[model samples]
Target: MSASPWLVGPFVDMLVGSGLAYLMTLPLLLIISVRTGFVGWPVLLVTLISILVSVPHYGATLLRVYEERSQRQRYALFAYYLTGILALVFLAGIYSIPIGSALLTLYVSWSPWHIGGQNYGVALTILRRRGVEVTPLVKRLLYVSFVLSFLLALLSIHVENSNHVPASGLQAARIYRVIPVGIPSALVSVVFPVVLMIYVGSVVGAFVGLVRRGVRGWPLVSVVSLVAAQALWFVVPALLFFWSGTDAEGLLPFAAIWISAAHSAQYLWITTHYARRIDPGIRTGTYLGKALLAGAFVTIFPGLLFLPDWLGAPSWAAGLGTLLFAVVNIHHFALDGAIWKLRDGHVARALLRDDPGLAAGKAEASVGLGRWGWRVVWIGGSIALAVTVHEQFERTVTLSGITLRSLDRARDAIARLEWTGRDSDSDHLVLANSYLQAGNPDAAEKEYRESLARRPSAEAVSGLAAVRIQRRDWSGALENYDRAQRLDPDNVDLMIRRSDLLNQLESETPPVDRAAIRDLQRRSIRLLERALDLDRRRVPTIVRLARVYTRSGRRRDAAALIQAALEGLEGLASTERAMLEREKRALSDPRSGSAAGTRAGPVRPGASGARP
Candidate 1:
């Protein structure tokens, strides 16, 4: 007798698994991080992320089993996609090593966006398709939760991991931050590709014994390919994102679990997709209850604790190794539950009976191809038309990737206006860069003053300040930094730069005051330290602290601190390592951090961590 399917199976699994890990690591991580001011934001944040991930784990595996037994290639295709995804994610784990561990943590950290953008969408889509119609009110609730969870996730990521975001401008690595394009933090990350190789080499490779050689699956293959398009592009990869970790040694077992759970979605979906044919509402909620509970217990509790540890691990092993091991154990449990349920006539048969398309239309192709052929042609054509229109519109606005757009035209016009006539200080400051680049320093000078006259913006003020720095107008640069600081207290760079200028003027002065030099250095160090506390991974702060230490005759201390900071960077990729190396060199060089770099004049503005 086959065990009946339980809709709550996954949830049960997650609760159980998480409960176990929770009992194990909670006392350790919590005790280490416990303090009055500490918000357990990471815990709530991670739990939220894990639930989104757990739901799909069993969903994917269930889908695979149903597809294989029922000749449902669509579900099989979806399951295969889970394979491709894990392959890519594990590959990235390889790449993050050597650069530094802290730098690479961003690639493996959990994000709320994946839950909203991928998990929620897939889960509801599966449920609705499986005949579990959501009420309008329920739908609204899910939508709101989805958005809120995502926003909160993003905030938590920012609050907890500030180093990944740049100071205030566009950075290529940050801009191209997804997997394959950047690191392996998301579902489509390169890590999955590595895991895929292992699976094929082992699981599917061994499952070759299960293949029926004489079977011809030509139509079935096409069906698989079609449904697979959705699973590959969005559904499975969403699950894959959760599997991304710091490195391969820690990623292997978790990748296995991720693949197993993600495949269950396909199993469940296949049962739903054909429930109209094979069975009707067949113990779906019950079997779902078991699979879901099984998955949830395995996924939820202890895993959340590891998220922070991984995000803050000294080594990749500390962060990801334990998490991966836990994931594998859950995967084994899920695989067993699914097989047992299937053999015992649980949820799968009930679902097949309920879905009209599966039993009533058995002669029809597995993926609804016969009826869906025309629909495909129409949808394909519509997509082509829309794409063509978009291309044409974009082409009209661009020439060699540079748009003859409003911003560019405005810049060009500003240049000609400055060149053709004299401008006020405020206006000149706004257009000084254009004039400078155009070989019109006189015009730039005139505009710089005019721009300053017209209620100086930080951008405009910084512009004039740079011009002063260029021309050795120390007084003017100090004046600009003071004004900018007034406008934006968080201008960390401006504070440091101002300190530098005060030092420069002292050397040119007749009786340079030693007292003033000490004062400026003290002020600069204070500002730098504040900024570092707000964001520990701040490169400028790191460099500035080293310089201050070197100047104060703490040479060995400076070196040790540098090593500690670099330790945070071990798992980073080569590009990231290079960036850190550059910063390290700039800090360590005596010439750059020389006493001359610390001569004093007027004091600079201090640093504050308050939001601008």
Candidate 2:
């Protein structure tokens, strides 16, 4: 007997299998909403979706592997040995950022390909079910199109966002601190467009081939929808990044959230179908309940058990979670690949046809646990899930408050988190930044010290420097700034800040002490020149350097710098352009002297004068 053309009919298959047409458009719309300030609860929403949809999908794979004794024995190497290895890796990753980042890199690199592979399998299954002969040429064409799509998306992510660092709170940005994997912009400029064109052409060729081979109706719709979803997920965003010449930091998180949710739902839809068909006695709810629990157990429970102390530290938690996530996904990818091959006679018989031959061997009897023992197990699982959910809820509130800039709400959430013993270095740093923004330099300094005590990062030291600047402890501020620069020598912002401080000190020096003033100017000049060397397009650095040149009696050099800035005026913001024009006028007027860019007093940290 032939297998049904549709799994649970056309509507369900199209909605779940193709992951709904809206799945393609929703990410773009949501990203726009977030960017425009229309959405404020994105973190909360994505977290909930992850708990409900994404986590359970991982459970589906576990159920497929260990639910039956015979299946467990068949895949023992993966189900037991490989899982044990991944567990050890996870433990190591909690302490070592490099190991954790390597694990994350593997998962990130493989994620798109895994999505493409699944879609490719589904499209082929649909075609076969519709009675279309899938020739080797047709298979090759489809395979190439999907692979190209994944490559296009992957390249776009690395290329377009190469220079854009996300907010410090984000997981990607945190990992990038240890492992910088950004591709060069010049290479992205050359390669992305070529790959995009080839991907588009391959997709079109595949569609035409399918049509020529008598593919029609739901099968064609499914294939077309899958291709469109791939494009929406990967290609369109890349195109947007390429066209706008902006970072994808705003869009990437939303895209990842929705795409993962959609992918998980699609996986569950097919896997559940397979499970029910292969074992007629299995109820859908029972199978899904087990899958959900198993998924939560593998993904969440282990983290809680092994890294209880690290949960409060967002940096450590994020890294550990990333490592755990990578391990689970790698295992899922490997096991799913092994079990779901259409080339396997048993898999083909079970999925492509309603054949019970695959289930002829009886499943091993359940462990003879008494009712009380079963009840205890369920109770323990429930408590674990409840704890996980509550932790997630607190995290969501804190992250939401941060994203929305609701300082009061953020403070309250942070307090609650710390009250629960979840206080972390990152949390303290965030509090310090909040205090700084609120103009409480003393409080900000205290928080910064607290953060540094837990973990000494450049950001924390920089925050302390800013606090000292606010208190007018110039020598103390310089000390902290020097420490910060030592931690991050290549940071252009730090170079500019230190230069600005020197310029302020020069303005304070008595005119009679020309040598001392000149020495300060020279030091400032060297710092600005170094900043310019690091980033030639940094207009602020160029403008600042020109001001120093005018003060140092290099009127010709200053005028030339101002002229170069004006030549690229179109790229400058209106304020930047106005500043440059004023500098040009000052350079032309010999009587203007040091009035053009000299600060009368110390510029506040993050003020226009400090940066400009």
Candidate 3:
């Protein structure tokens, strides 16, 4: 029971344990570089990681389950039956958006909890391997910390007012349409900090308890590193949202990519250790080769089934890849749960001990498959890998072109993809955004319609509304915005945009059309008020609501709101602060009448009016 054995080695263990910091921070740094006019090429970074790390990690679980006869028999229900069931579900999703979106939602919603479980299991394994007494009470503290951290991360992701669009090419493959399980922003504002504090307290309390029990050395360092990694993965981001009002939507996509990558690497690290110990003779290279082949097949081969012509589905039936991706991940989560139980005798012996007899039950022979069968698998998987790499490279080029505002490069890559019949709703939406950026409203409108025809999304609908705004089709723009709001009911930005549009219509109405003006003013007031209710501290909403109040002859309410906004102007951007000042001055002038009321012109369509 000496604490002498390390899972891999002390260095590797510690590095993987603390790797989340590097994984998550790298995306943020890349984003900063992009913002500062440097080419970060994040799409390329994500593609490489998926091929090298993420996909293979899923393969590691399959290898663990089916590599040996005993494991296959022990987990037959999961390995054989459940996988078949999920495959059918995947196919169903290919033809039905609601079904596909729900499946995608389940995968995303489960991801944080799955990651938390891994971190919790790893921490306990580290402690037990080092001979630290993991009493029931100690386990409870660690469990609570991890659970709260997961909750914090989950809440930040699905908040009602947050943007739900896929923000990166990595996410674009899986997130067809997020079925948000929204926590209200008001509730998040109140709950996030309280839970974060308790989470921190639990971590500190667990560490102090472990130390009092004489847990020291690499075990202590490793466990502490895992805790710190979780904080970096979850807590710090929540803090940024709750404290500084940074939008979680802007950060969650990158967070999801990095956290998944880091988690996968950790999974591989432990599984490789277990595999080596269990076989005692299998080279790491051989095992990884089999794992990568299995991973590539699982991740990519199914996508071929979803090809536009494969099942005679229409070309717009493009998100079957997303469904397949979700199903694969769900399958991976299931197998991992069943096979990696520490309470199971075989699992414990393999992971916690270095006894020579650990390999006594080694069964490396191919199960039910002959040499040629494996060769077929290897050949098919390699082909799929090549195809996926090429596809992903093109995607990288398209996204990078869009990011850098090289519209021709993006258009060329997109056309090539479409020619290959690889068109997707997200790709169309992205191209539409690029078209809008290039000021080709006609092309933007066409792309947006194409996207909607493929799969109706709030983003696509919003893009169409932006095109309408650019055309000065105020009624049409309002209609599309209303439609977008229906799709994304709790979107604060959409609410503000609708209110702004209403105010614009009101100002342009003939003064003699008092009824029409009144109607517009009332609707604008309601939308702005709703936005304020969703996020009371949103200064722009307050300012807009105040202007509506003034126009509608609620001078006292308008003055009160302007004063409140002015009090908080110090934290706003300089341009925003100056705009608010001007509004306040106009509202205060005695000679100012309807002319001084907020008369927002058609803003650049698709541009957000304020931070949510």
Candidate 4:
């Protein structure tokens, strides 16, 4: 027997460097981490690659907008809508959590559609390049397959919690009330298998036709490989993550990171290609210029948006920044979803101009199987498919039950708090956090107040302060922070939070209040300084204070503070040590601004606070 030939041309030119292709490679790479019980270098490398690739793609899109008047007009409307929505969400969040939570749920639901749609688009693009005509039936099947995969992934949320294991350790925080779309999980379960079976049958039929129609060579191989990759890479993860019960804890992170990276890579490939192709002069000089242009695009949002947080901006500013990010993401999804349509004559002509067959207007051909082939597929595939589907269903239900129970427990905790009165500050604090997650800031405030009344606890005071910050009651929040500081003067975290809010207030306030703004900034600096004085070796606090000093135009103080933070940090991991150096450079560099380009680099949310 001969080993299957490993083809390299398609892997290099079409698949590996692009979105879906990179995504398909995830399962193979993750095997090392899964077996070894730790994520090694490969995971870290891919994550970095994903972040780097993701931004350039956005830049590519923006470059097109800058060059093309039509593109600008098309995108400007979406940009305005996104801006308006973001402002609404920010203002709404100040009043109540429910409205913001509802919008968040809507965005979350739309995300899978956006992601899956992109995958489907990639598949179509691949087929078009191969000149493989897809009938409406085949198109429907492809769409269904991608949609089903997303649905399964959605059902798989909190799979670890289903087994009584909280992966990220915020079980309460995760138990928010998401308004169900009224479709029963059981109904989705029943329909999913049928749709999946049909999708598989259609894919198999298509592959058989490709072979029978003498579609051999790289084109044939590419299409087959893509289908196989989608099945193994996409479908399997969705089913396992959503439907599997065992060892899901080990699998979740790998899937999340890989998917994210793949998505970013894909965006970069398509958008960059589109931009360069559309506007030949966009980067006519050299590859370096193109790279720089893409970098600028990547930097625009990430660079400025995270400034408030980096300077220790209050909860409202951070929340507003978060809302803006979400809005941009949602806009990206919408624009991408609408703009790329291969079936449209204009789009097909524009994107597929190089491929005459793909650009040509021709009727799609339907491919079907012979009776014997259908009989074989139905009989042989039935028993095997049934067993697999049944097992998945059982696992899904068992896992889903765990999440349901967690939600029930959360509700019970809230009810108990209501009945018992705020006797236990700890329990009230827990319930308060839960209420906030559940989108009930009013209840959270009541509980926090009760807790504070029972005891002048720093935690309760801070919690209340946070609620006020979210409500945009800056004075109230600062007053609470002051009280909390009095209660526990040595609390570094509280001081940092206070400083952050103060910095945000100073930056956001009008130029008319120069004296007031200066006073606020000075107060922020003092807060951070006091915290640092209490614990000089605290790297996080030191870095934070450095940020405040830089913001206050005290570059020398900022550089000195960053230098102090970097001391005795040689024992830290390579990444951590490298980050400290970046901070030092950012502070010392004359060109680096407080909120723009900094030595610490772009403040990507969810990254360690070292950047902030």
When superposed on Cα atoms, how far off is each prediction in RMSD? 20.7, 5.5, 7.4, 24.1
Ranked by TM-score, the better of candidates 1 and 3 is: 3
Model 4 residue 370 lDDT? 39
Q: What is the C-alpha lDDT profile of model 3 across 39-105, one tens digit per residue?
A: 3336667768887888788888987887777788889999889988987877777777788788777
How far does residue 47 in candidate 3 sit from its true spot (Å)?
0.5
Residue 546 CA displacement from its true place in model 1, Å: 7.3
Across 1-612, the per-residue lDDT of candidate 1 in tens digits comes to 113222234443222211222223334543544443332333233333333444434433443343233433533443345434433443333234333233233333332233233334443433432344445554454444444433322332333222322110011121122222233245323544444444234323222321222212321222223223223322233333334412221212222223223434443444333333344444656444434433443232223333322443221122233223223333333343334232243344443223234454333322433445534433543443333233233323321233223334444443433331211233344356555545455655566665554334565666666666656677787787778778777876666666566555544655545676566556657766766666676554565566666665556666676677779744656655565567567556766653224433333322211110
Write one digit per residue (lDDT tens) for candidate 2, span 1-612.
Answer: 345777667777888887664565676666677678553335557667776778788888977777666677788898889889987887677666777767766666667788889988888877776788877877887888889877765765466344322211235334423233677878877887888787777788888888898888778888888888777666676676677865554555455666777788888888888887777788878877777777777766665555334453333343445566677888888888777888977667766775767556557524333456445445655655775666567676555456425666666665665443444568778878877877878777788887776567888998988887777766677677779889899988988888888877777788888899888889888888888888877777787898888788787888887797688545777887887777787777767764455442366764111543
lDDT head-to-head 1 vs 2, winner = 2
Inter-residue clash pairs, candidate 2: none
After TM-score superposition, the amount by which residue 209's alpha carbon in candidate 3 deviates from its true location, in angstroms, is: 1.5
Q: Top model by lDDT, which number?
A: 3
Clashes of 4: 3
478-577 per-residue lDDT for model 4 (tens digits)? 7887888898889887787777667656656777877887788789788878887787656666666677677667878877766765675456666666
lDDT of all predictions: 0.41, 0.71, 0.74, 0.53
RMSD of 2: 5.5
TM-score of 1: 0.29
**Candidate 3: lDDT over CA atoms?**
0.74
